[model samples]
Target: MTAPESGDVWSFDYLWRWQHERGETEGRKPRPTALVACVKGANGRTNLFILPITKTRPSDDRLAVEIPQIERVRAGLAADLRLWVMIDEYNHDFLETSFYLDPKGRIGRFSSAFHKAVLAAFVQAGREKRLRKVPRYD
Candidate 1:
């Protein structure tokens, strides 16, 4: 399989805020996670920045982007359900050696426009000091 690209949604064992705070390194369950960025380090290791997608509505304190129906279909998500991409926080993992990311296969890719919007939102959150990075790799 080729290396993962931005906007590729995968079923990943995502660790939540509560879980991460309690010193838990493992995620509770597998969920749809969108690959927002892929950066290659000097050692040739790819660091994947992924955001979790959920049907749950974001709280006032959380910053998220609502997934359009067409975008949901493009990403191979359930079009019937209202989905939101949490941009205020993300999980960072290594594409090459992640125990959390198996070679099962990705759901699909989001449209370039939607994917760019997600990235923009994430950056804004970061600049506002609202972005949380949940490290999935030690």
Candidate 2:
């Protein structure tokens, strides 16, 4: 199982290519960011991040394509991520627009309350593990 290059944003096609070459079964889901937990990708559930090739890199210093969203949200390391079932309501509008961590530290993306719940659950689980301690974002 090959992991994406650190600090690099990956396009859908590129990610699919990697999956194909590696015989992975994790398909692209309708999420704002292209990270998912697959029952058959590397592990049962893995932290994978993907961004389109067009807006891959936004930082002037970094020439590589990396999503600034990840940095803002303070997601835990791969070993610290929690796997939660993605409900249809939570998935709505997730892929249509980009998400950001607001000044209040709450997830600011889609307008779906369900999605917010899912993200909150993930954060809570990670906190319990103490693997990734994001500052209070209540």
Candidate 3:
């Protein structure tokens, strides 16, 4: 997919499955799977996807399995060890507050913040020679 714009539509399931399989192989923990339904704007970028909350042992039951996934995503994109902690904090906040956001602004502010956070993480990771940002299509 050409870089998503504001209005470009993408699938949630595709990104979710991609993250899940990638997490299993390259990650140290299990992460939640995602599925894309549709886009709400014209920017053609990453957007919200469903993450059904599930309670599991040794993990917070409120956030479901998303914490691991968010952390993995952060770590996968982290260039330096410093980002690990920062990303972890951001991940925690995202999972915790996502439910309280006004549905109307989620696509714009909250979703954009999530995407920006990940992008920053990846850029840092790439700059530190941790990984390369490969173009992917969903």
Candidate 4:
């Protein structure tokens, strides 16, 4: 499988496992996520850093960036879909596992401007101490 490039949107099976009010539970949820970075490891596997993309608008604009409806449509999403890139919801996975990049699930790449905005949001999150540090990909 090819490593997904930065700005490329792909469907991810995000495993949500956490200790809730009752006890620990897990769910495999499928969603579209933007590949923000792909770092090749020494073992020849690539580690993918990604941010979740949602169809719902974010309550905090400072933590998200809106992807224009037109751009979303061009990326193979619904024409009327309201998409937002959630910067705070960053996650990582190895290319050999966890991530799925089927052609049918790809939503295409975002514009350079949008990619920059996503990076800026990461910087903001770091400055606010919400994010420890931004991951570097070679």
Candidate 5:
């Protein structure tokens, strides 16, 4: 499979670490994530900025913007799926690191207008202090 570019949605084997009653445990969770940006590091490896795509609506609508069903379908998502771009939920990973990009998980690239809106939301989130981590693409 080729490297994912910005606006492309792919399936990822995400290591979800959470606190358990006994201790911390990790689970391999399959999730659809969007490649927000790709940056070349000093070491020459690409660093990927990614955000999770979800069917669940965020309590704060400002944190997430809904993708129209038709657009979502065009992006290779299920036609009946109600998807939202979770701008506030994002993380960075090196292209050669622990992140696993599943070939079968490739959805499709979002529209240019949607990409622009997502970038705008990121900026708004930063200004509103709603984002836990500010995207480095700025």
Candidate 6:
């Protein structure tokens, strides 16, 4: 729990941008989230960025990557359940001190190759300047 690696998947309260825009401070429930990055800010606190995974198929307007069947198993999710990781947006939280992230909530991890693919797509999303970020901490 001290150091969050990029491929790690965990049950997290991932707040969406729309929810925050509506003045919602916390996520509705803890769901599977993909750890994208962990950065140390100037103040020395580690910032955790994550993408939410959902079973609902993304709309045409949204950008998402489907979790491969093998990778799904690697992540400890139901092998038969179709899931996608939304790359167009991400949830930001404090890794050093967070009320939403619990150590016991950790699931399995995606393979390095899969994580790399997701990261690549995420970086592409960033380049497009359409990535919506929802900051969970004040």
TM-score, predicted candidate 2 vs. hidden true structure = 0.20
User: Which one wins by lDDT: 2 or 5?
Assistant: 5
What are the models' TM-scores?
0.95, 0.20, 0.25, 0.72, 0.77, 0.95
Q: Estimate, for each residue in 1-138, the C-alpha lDDT of model 5 and write its tens digit.
A: 677787788886533222222243332476777777777889987887777777887685447778888768767887787888777656566776533555567779888778778878876877887765422221
Scored by Cα lDDT, where does model 3 land?
0.29
Instruction: Report, for all candidates in order, the number of backbone clashes.
Output: 0, 2, 19, 0, 0, 0
lDDT of 3 by residue, 67-103 (tens): 3344434424222222211111111112222332223
**Higher-lDDT candidate of 2 and 6:** 6
What lDDT score is found at residue 44 in candidate 3? 44
RMSD of each: 1.0, 17.6, 13.7, 4.8, 4.5, 1.1
Residue 18 C-alpha lDDT in model 3: 41
The local distance difference test score of each candidate is 0.90, 0.29, 0.29, 0.64, 0.68, 0.90
Per-residue lDDT for 27-83 in model 1, tens only? 888999899999998989999998999999999989999999999999899999999
Off by over 4 Å in 4: 16-27, 41-44, 99-104, 132-138
TM-score of 4: 0.72
Model 2, runs deviating above 4 Å? 1-111, 130-138
lDDT of each residue in 1-138, candidate 4, tens digit only: 444787787776543222222342322466877777777989998877777777777775337778888668655666677888777656666666552445466667777777777878876786787742222222
Error of 1 at 109 (Å): 0.7
Q: Could you tell which candidate, 2 or 3, scores higher by TM-score?
A: 3
